[model samples]
Target: MKKFLMLLLALLTVMVIAACTANEDAGEDPTDSEEPDTTEEGTNDDDEDATDDGTEEKVLRLNNGIEPSSLDPSIGFDAVSWDPLNNLMEGLTRLDQDSRAAEGVAESWDISDDGLTYTFHLREDVNWSNGDPVVAEDFVFAWKYMLDPETASPAAFLGYFIEGAEAFNSGEGSADDVNITAVDEKTLEVVLEAPTGFFLDLLTNPAFFPINHQVAQDNPNWHTEAESFVGNGPFKLESWEHDVEMVFTKNEHYWDADTVKLDKVHFAMVNDSNTQYQMFESGELDTASIPPELSDELIDGDNVFIGDYGGLEFYRFNITEEPFHNKNIRKAFAYAVNRADIAEYVVKNGVEPAYGFVSPGFTSPTGSDFRDENGDLVTFNPELAQQYLEDGMAEEGYNELPEIVLTYNTSDSNKAVAEALQSMFNEHLGVEVTLENQEWNVFAEAQQNLELQFSRSSFINDYSDPVNFLESFVTDSYMNRTGFSSAEYDELIEKGKSETDEEQRWEYLYEAERMLAEEMIAMPIRYYNTVVLEADGVSGILRHPVGYFDLKFADKN
Candidate 1:
């Protein structure tokens, strides 16, 4: 019976991969962008198999664009952490083959009619890599820990859907008041402040994953070292040489271990995409993301894939700082840049011009899109940009504007975009903007702390819901580092969250998006499209619309 189950799982995995390959060949991906990947128009040979001891080892080598900020589920919130966390941790819900909510730690769950209460039934056989049984209490500990001010989880606001989570996170209420509770060892319950249509979808985020309280208490730095890293997913950390390399091996203790085909996965922290691409070409890496400039030239055959990834790249102004504090100046900056030009020339990847914060394809309950409702909220007009700059100068009582510095992380693609924007500002607005580049981790920390005056930014949806994008601008949101806040904006978001009527809720969100566009708080650039190169032998790799790819089902020929 066990062997039959394993065979069935393997067959199912093949079917999923076949479908993904078919989509790639047809120039279709679920990334929400309509552009097709530029692929070579010919077939490629399969990867040659190497035999050792009469058996081929299924090892996959990949490269990461940046070193992960943190492995602790509560602390890490970016793609660097998310890519590995997707393998190292399992939450109550996970993105399934169809990218919908599916079973993870909790095999089944029920929601109350009021839509405010959720009860989860965990699997009995799941265990941490340390042989400790994963129970409901672990989730409770993790949730409360995130809400605790000391943890300082940048994603703590994600828990605000729970009844008292916001109050507890803000230090206005005690931990006991938080609505997350474990009814028993296998049963967990959560109470929300109101009906959130996307509550289940949100659980797929790392912030809601279970944490072994004992391990955490015994070693505060457990996640930093591979020896102490305990996970309950299909893979466990085998070793980690900080900022250099990391490795993972299949977890024999995982609930569905029989189905996890791959024996091991290797990750190298090669921050340069071009270098990673070179490694891929030289057969040193099995998979690598290609930079925009090389997208057309690099595809050797059938291994290239392009996906929309459902993300928006933008520039954020420090509203509390000088020059940028003037609303007209912010508007001027937005109007000066030509998004169409960047999307076509600079990004060249299958990306679309973004006129607002919420990327298109975020559909409401009624099946209508928010972006469709709010069309082209911002536009490019060099003459109007010049006028706005002059108005801003007059408002600030300055004859000329000071030199503004634009900051971005170091990458071939980022450098190109930054240079393009620098030229645009010089030509259109006549404002000389200096460009600064920092390494990935350093740039991320600076952006999080609002240490830079103006910086390149992007937000990939944590969940498919529009609230994921709208909530970032809330006054107390840690993601809101721009220091731009308005009571009216918060009220609109609140109303959208609590509104029972689907249409009315969408209206509230649309109003908030319009207000953000008019205020010019953040300049939207282009929507992201995930582009990558993979070995032909690699299959069953799942890239979610939110921009992270999963390796649980991956197998090498």
Candidate 2:
């Protein structure tokens, strides 16, 4: 009897040991694969983000570079390329899918019959990242600060529509003269010079977005560093390592957190297109955006990639002084560039050659006959370009040829494009072209100051409107690096906006585009479809027309 009892106890112990081993093997974790199980529970690699019961947590990764240019929306504007600022920061209004102005922070709005006064209604429950109530004063402060010439904001032109804004931006009046006030806590009123249809859409931009006035004042460099700022959108910046990596975490205080799928997002700022492709190849990255040159391999996996998106890539010449000041000189330079070769040999397929100022498929309620009446694309004619160069030089009273400098971003692709242009201009037009290379940030600074000669310039539009692109060179426009002003352009632009008839408006705009293109005030090359890489298990991310995507909606498997 004793022997039988001992044998039964041994058998029971063996069964218990077997059951424990099975549980350990089955309950493996995903993250633990990267690290050993040193914790007390000896959790599996995948279980790092999961609960003991195996329910997983959600996080995402996104790769972004540089901190924001400015937190003061009204002043340091241009969030088109750097869209997280525009996406994360809620404005008085927002844009709907149809690209029309819609409600966002403002529930609704009213305009006075006079056609000059505008009012906006704020959302009641909106809260800042620090849990501060978002209110009317935030906008007022942002406006006043931006308009203050002392602020030295790069986007000061955004304030031009407002009454007294021009004088204020021009340093005639204090930023205080620009009148925006709160009728009460929720109601805010603004007075503009005229009734502008684009004003509402402008408000939807980050340039007019309300900021936590106190926070912005407290952290002057908030946007330059990741830790110092806050976001009202679905995600808040979690970590940033310039030129390296960036991470974002879901904002719990977000007004719409339920729809915010990713709990965390990580981004790797890869400079090389090839290296970026490698990361996508290894499945380490969910999406990779590359120039057309690198997309040939991606063509095989049509299910894994999508390439067509609207954007423009063009060269900008400084028309403020020297040789470029002459219209024909600018025209001559434009004629020298062969955008077709670049798009075909450099970028791959899906991007069409840009023959007009505004790209096709890009539209606004305003008309889009931006091409000539002939319905023909602009052509590259070396002989005509040479004629212009000779005429410009003769008109300038210069018998000697002047050496022109072209500035470009130091990226390999950009340099290659610049080199092609250099060869074209020198070989055919008999112009000596000097090349200057700088980093992107420095390039932006130079552009803002009109310090660059012919700059490798093409930025995604802030809004899809032709006005957004054409109006960029408007007199006193912030993005107008060319410094070329035309009375005809100003008149046509004003007429286009003020005309009640849609056909007349289009007529005015088309007239203006023709003049601008013919004058060669600013060179327009080809529009490009943004190329983005897609990875499995990342979903719900949306890319804006301006080449920005939000990973806050993306979820990892």
Candidate 3:
């Protein structure tokens, strides 16, 4: 019996082994195979794989699309084009290498007993590009000059946050009477009306950049004139021709002079992206962008710079005017137009559609989000919009809406959107819309004047905050050219500033946005990916929430 049991066990073991082998064979097919990657594009970036013996000089040439026409920090500067500007003229406090506010012109600041007052300590030995001692009074002058109504500075909006800034800007008070004062050679004091929560970020604005006050006073047109320039940051404008090219040389006297590796930085006006891309590929231009029409073919995992942006490209209506004054009309207009169609067709080339003023990934440290009832979010609802428009038309006693005018910038991408929207509004809502295109500079002025019935303008938040975009439209805001002011909206915004409870504050903000969106104050289009082309070796170009890409700390690798 023992011999027979041993034989049975041996047979069972063989049977189990054979079954396991059969299962393994059925699970995977040996005939299917993939080889290792020997392709050039799939290689990892390490020291050995970096180049084909490419040992080029560190001098990098950055080919930005447009040139900064005015070196004046105050002149109607677009932060989009001012990244290099802030590099040259830094603020007392500035966005860090990673977009957070850090010390720049001033070493430190101390707030007083009243939250409204602040005292700042400057870095003593800092010098200007011309080798002049940078004093506390330089910043003081810059602040006052911006507040002066005659300066016509777009940056003045930032100054308005300070005490008496509004009065000074509106010509109700002298620039001299503005609250900033130089306590001594190295100390500066500022007085504010309320606790400006984002004050540090406000200090990060170019309007606070120190300038040679004497030069500015001597030459009023110093912005456009060659005789009126000095530097507080890394680079100095050696030369610039309007709409042409700009040349910059490193500041020999910069406080961080030892760290600035690049000796010269240059920019040329090549607005056309394709022309710019060809130059970049040929090694003539260092960096270039794929134009809207060509973005998809160019965009992929390789060589793609992907990140969150703080800008919102919204469609605004002149609310103080007739058509927009009617909330129903606004609702009807929003319903009449299709956002998905706009997102797919009008805003082609990977631009994300905007559901509200604030985009995701953007944060507000002091405040909460500006979301709505569904919690700071709302998507296209054509059926709902149609009902609102139908009601509005009935109230206005009109079966068909009159012809509307939409003014947009003459950019290659913008024209496509405006033309597409014109058709969408006409066919979807039965509204006749005319598209009027104009030069960028001219179009900006017209939109600000409320001359256009409807316009497309974008506001990139100065800081990653809810207030940065929403507060800029509060009745008294300079950018509030549409005159869209509601007492309820204003109260809710002001309440949000002081509400100690975090959740309540957010609720109020969300309510205000819901009111605004429901009222159809304006239609949000989408958020843009700020694409730029820079030289291969250029690193440390600081990107900001506001489109200003300041490059002072930038060093060529």
lDDT of 2 by residue, 71-102 (tens): 44554443322455654677787666444667
Query: How good is model 3 by TM-score?
Result: 0.83
Best by lDDT: 1
User: What global local distance difference test value does model 2 have?
Assistant: 0.62
Worst window of 10 by summed lDDT in candidate 3: 31-40
- Estimate the TM-score of every prediction: 0.89, 0.82, 0.83
What ordering of candidates by lDDT runs from best to worst?
1, 3, 2
Please list the residue runs of candidate 2 whose C-alpha ends up more than 4 Å from where it truly belongs after superposition: 1-54, 65-67, 71-81, 97-99, 303-311, 362-377, 394-400, 430-432
lDDT of 3 at 506: 62
Local accuracy of candidate 1 as per-residue lDDT tens digits, 1-557: 24323433453354335433322112111111111122111111134344456676677887654457788888877777777888988899888888888999999999999999999999999999999999999999999998899999877888988999989999999999998888999999999999988888899987788998789889888888899999998899998887667888889899989988888778776654445555677677887775555545654447777765777888889888888999999999999988887786666656788888888878776776878877888888888998899999999998888779999766546666787788788878878899998865577668768788898878878888887787788896777778888999999999978899988988998899899888887899998766677877888888888656678888978
- Model 3 lDDT tens row, 386-485: 7877887788787676667888765445655676666656555667788887765676667777887888777766555565666656776667767787
Candidate 1, residue 108: CA error in Å?
A: 1.0
In order of listing, the candidates' clash counts read 1, 18, 7
User: Model 1, residue 52: what's the lDDT?
Assistant: 53
Model 2, residue 524: distance off in Å is: 1.6
TM-score of 2: 0.82
Candidate 2, 161: how far from true, in Å?
2.5
